[model samples]
Target: MQPYCKLKSSTRSLSKLVACSALLLLLDLSRCFSHHTYEWQDSHTNERLVCKQCPPGTFVSQHCTRDSPTICKQCPKLHYTEYWNYLESCLYCNVFCNFLEEEAQPCNSTQNRACQCKPGYHAELDFCIEHSSCPPGSGVAQLGNPQQDTKCSQCPQGTFSSVSSMDPCRNHQNCSAQHLEVNVPGNRFHDTFCTACKISKGSEASDGLEDGSGSEDCQDAVIDFVPYEIRVPRRLRRLKRIVSRSSQSSKRDRKSLEELQMELHTYLVQLKNTEKKELLLMFITAGIVSQSEVAPFQISAGKESLQVRRK
Candidate 1:
């Protein structure tokens, strides 16, 4: 009986030791899981591990094992990881700005590079374009900024602009109402050109006509010289008197009269070749005719009659 009692006491002691070992193992597992650690099994070694998360701006190079801690590395230049991750490699941060654009902010481990349009350039959809300049006869309605294009508007009446630029149009010159005539009319791109009115001698004031007293004799001579339309002004009528009085003049005056006659002959030849009645009328109205001797002139065009008398 003493030998059987010793065997039973030894068996009870072995069972108690086994229960205590199991309880200690469960406590260790609960403590590990409660601390936010996760277990990962290795495929090659079949070993379990508790892995810690990688910090920001770094990536996990190797997972943790039961015997070793997790391995991590900082992200290289031009690479980034914005948050804690278990990725094996960092993301590339090599974004580039296009033409007409510039880098506003450089890339770093935590953020990407920012881009913006350059000066004198505006954003248009996905690209950039240069600002537009206002053209002649127009003004800049709105100036351009870095993010927007320029706006233009036409110049109003009494204003003019001659060149393309960002400046506003200028006001046109106003002609005097009394003595000046509008030689060239005002336009959006050019100012008005004015000329003084021609005053006549004696009692009658010929506003545009040249001074002449011997007009009837020249009228008869012109009728015999040309059959076609020749609207001669009063100044041209005086040329007949120059020819009639040339023989009575001195040697110097005769030489001057001859040169004048040659110039008139050349002009008449050009007028005949061109046969431009409107050009001849403009010469008559603008007082371009000379008071010198004219050669025999003949022009033939349609049935338009010649008016030698000045209005």
Candidate 2:
């Protein structure tokens, strides 16, 4: 019984000693954190004392001793110390701005270099990506900045975005205001295409301007952007005077020219009487061909339908 009692007392003392040691260790850690200490021990007396940390933009010139505090000196140019530290040297400004990046913040004693993506580009992860353009049927909802990507939205009804760009959608054209017929209706991707109806006597569409200038052009119809070479023959050579140039012209010049002529002849055959009159007038005005040069064809002018013969 005596031996058991002694063993129990020894166990209790050991447990108490362990608890005290743990409490002391926790208190030491809390004190170090609250005061931000760098504790140093004297080798001879085993005495420990806290050393002061250098502030930002500075470094420790010398460590603390028994009688003196930590010696500090301001960091040199191009060196940085962001926080209170006992570091022997400051860090270098290693970040550099590339072509796709711009300097947002220059390197200083307390901070390092900072970079951002250039205009028309947005940062993603570690790289800069060019802003994406909206498609034909869509438009830009929100433009992008250095930190984000471009946002796009579908074009709404009665509006159209004909081209892929960062611009917003535009309203469709009003055909009635132009005194024309809606040949093709507008949607999200394309504007309304208009065409001219035949001008009859006492018709509403024929009420032209007082200057009498509305009959010639089909009432300002949307004519395609035809190239000069495609619309008129070039006066380069004998072949050029007949038809425009093509890729196969070099290999089979005469045959291709004849084929192009046949195609033009077919188109002319398909044109309406009013269109034929307009074509003849255009040719006469532009000096491309003469009235006598044209073959036999029928045309209509205002109230009269006239037939022309080669003369």
Candidate 3:
């Protein structure tokens, strides 16, 4: 009877253990099912509904009901969502290429337009501005890019620029006029200045006496007018005549003609300088030169010269 009692007690303990294991397995299965069911619940609605998320490039047109799936529509023109969303309407694309800006990329259902600065303009902060040019006496320190403006710096000593551009400053010209000495050293902002020699007349005379030359002979003659002013127009006229006569000149002569053209250009620069100085002097003396008279003076370069015409 004791052995039978012991076997019956072991059987009861095994049955209780089996019942507990079954209950734990059922509890796990129920929890998993509940999680799966609630995963797609709509949070905005009072009555929670199982709703699938709208895909990218689309927006929800209608909410999911108990028996229906979420209704979605493709984003309209110039509209985009980019990512999956539960939004009721598509987002409007706000990017636009204005007058100074250009379209880098066109708008699509999934993305907004991309913009950049147009040619001759550069982006600064949030907007576009006209590209800057290095003015005369300055040079481009840094080139302009799509996103940045051109940077300019003052030309260093012994160099200069005469026009507004992106070019580097050029070296100052040496004094070439006879019997003249440099009065002022050139800087980045101004040209090298030249003037007559400042040695005393008595010193020059003494030097001449030592060399057995007269005082008058020792002194260099001061020019009344710039040689370039008198010579350039005549040279230009001569070149034009040559060009007219050279219609039959061979291609081999073209090289010589180009050399002449370069020479002419140098002369023209000198003439321009002379004229500029003269005009400045006239302004200082007379305050103003009549525009009509100035026009005629420019046209009749050889026949009419600038004179103090009292009227």
Best by TM-score: 2
lDDT by residue (1-311, candidate 2, tens digit) is 22212334545787776776777788778867777558777566678878888889999898788888889999899899999888989999899999999999999999999999999999999899999999777899999999998999999999888667989889899988998655446778667765553322231122222122334344222121011113233322223233322334343344333233334433443553445444444443445544333211122236322112212
TM-score versus the correct structure, for each prediction: 0.36, 0.56, 0.41
Name the regions of candidate 1 deviating beyond 4 angstroms. 1-74, 81-88, 156-160, 170-311
* Best of the two (1, 2) by TM-score: 2
250, model 1: CA deviation in Å?
A: 51
Where's the lowest-lDDT run of ten residues in candidate 3?
217-226
Q: Which lDDT values do the candidates have, in the order given? A: 0.54, 0.60, 0.53
List runs of model 2 lying over 4 Å from the truth: 1-31, 41-47, 173-183, 193-311
Q: Candidate 1 overall Cα lDDT vs. reference?
A: 0.54
Cα lDDT tens digits, model 1, 25-107, are 88778777556355677777898766876777888888887677778899889988877667789888877998878998787
Please, what are the lDDT tens digits per residue for candidate 3 over residues 91-114?
888988888888888898888899
Off by over 4 Å in 3: 1-46, 49-52, 62-72, 124-127, 156-159, 170-187, 190-311
On the 0 to 100 scale, the lDDT of residue 304 in model 1 is 16
- Cα displacement (angstroms), candidate 2, residue 251, comes to 24
Model 2, residue 88: displacement in angstroms?
A: 1.1
